[model samples]
Target: MAPKVLFVLTSHNKLGNLDKPTGWYLPELAHPYHVLHGKTDITVASPKGGEAPLDPASVDAAKDAVSVAFLANHEAVWKTTRKLADFKGKAADFDALFYVGGHGPMFDLVDSATSQQLIREFWEAGKVVSAVCHAPAVFYDARLSDGSLLVEGKEVTAFTNAEEEQAGLTDVVPFLPEDALNKASGGKFVKGEELWAEKVVVSGRLITGQNPASATAVGEAIAKALGV
Candidate 1:
């Protein structure tokens, strides 16, 4: 049987204090899904149980073949995502947990108690807990069984402070991803040589990607870790 992977997406559609819309980034979710589609059993989920919103800017930014194919062929998976809370205490059912990123997660998933609980469960179960780009925001408040921050001393990367500024959302986001991860990891957060460079860091069972360009590699990392 293929490994079971749970893909968590943000439900918040509105960007922080702005009229603009945001949700999961298209390529961050689509590229990984495209890579793992046949090799694993994926369960799409969100904080809310219904349709997961897509970041409109990402849709426009990522018009690649993989992203376009995902939007066209996998509507059903994301359109009706499972409620994240429903998976509580059920972490043993899956082999990995993946968080999809966008500006929206910085608002909702970052401080979500349910999300924090799920991350703890997955970590304690010896399963992979991974996220890409801004999705690592979910790790901001997650703690392990020992009550230590999940990313503490763990090598991790996320949408960098520079990239956030490049996107012109430095002041708009609830918190900067790179700064938050660095603090969470006790300054262990690292980045690629340049902005938008593809970088995937695997610290034990935790996998993180630096930006949208790293999404596909993050998925491949998950597949390799799972031996799928």
Candidate 2:
């Protein structure tokens, strides 16, 4: 049987108090969905559930074919996402857990006790754990069995501080994902030479991608780790 993957998306949609709209990056979810859809069974979940919001900036159909295709089938996929709080599935039921990111996860998943538990459960169960871009924020409070952070001593990557500066939302976001990961994990945070360059780091079963451009690569890494 193919491995089942749980995809966690952010339900929060606002960029701090700026009133600017923000949610999961479309390509972050779309590209991975396309890459892993055939290899594994996927179920989308979110803090608030329902239809998870999408970052307006990531909706350019002209440039993102996978995202465009995902939107075209939004009714079948996006509309059916389950609420994380309500998901009855156990960690052992799935082979891996993936977190899709945008500025939204920094606000919600970062401090979500439920999310932390899920991550811990999945990791302790020996399931693959992965995140990309701002999704790495989910690891801010996720602790391992040893009480250390799951990212601690593990090679990882996420939305870099420089990338946040480039996006000019360094101040707008509640906290920098890279900074949180660094402080929480006390591990080396890696980045690519240029902003948005595809970079995926795999340390054991933990996988991370630097930015939106690294989404597909992250998916591929996760697939390989799962031996799919």
> Which prediction has the highest TM-score against the true structure?
1
Which regions of candidate 1 fall more than 4 Å away from where they truly are?
Answer: none
Per-residue accuracy of model 1 over 141-207 as CA lDDT, tens digit each: 7998898999998899999999989899999998888888899899999899999999999998999
Residue-level error in angstroms, candidate 1, position 144:
1.2
On the 0 to 100 scale, the lDDT of residue 38 in model 1 is 96
Going through the candidates in the order shown, the clash numbers are: 0, 0
TM-score for each predicted model, relative to the true structure:
0.98, 0.95
Candidate 1, pairs of clashing residues: none
Please give the range of 10 consecutive residues that has the lowest summed lDDT in model 1: 136-145
Model 1 vs. true fold: TM: 0.98
Candidate that would win on lDDT: 1
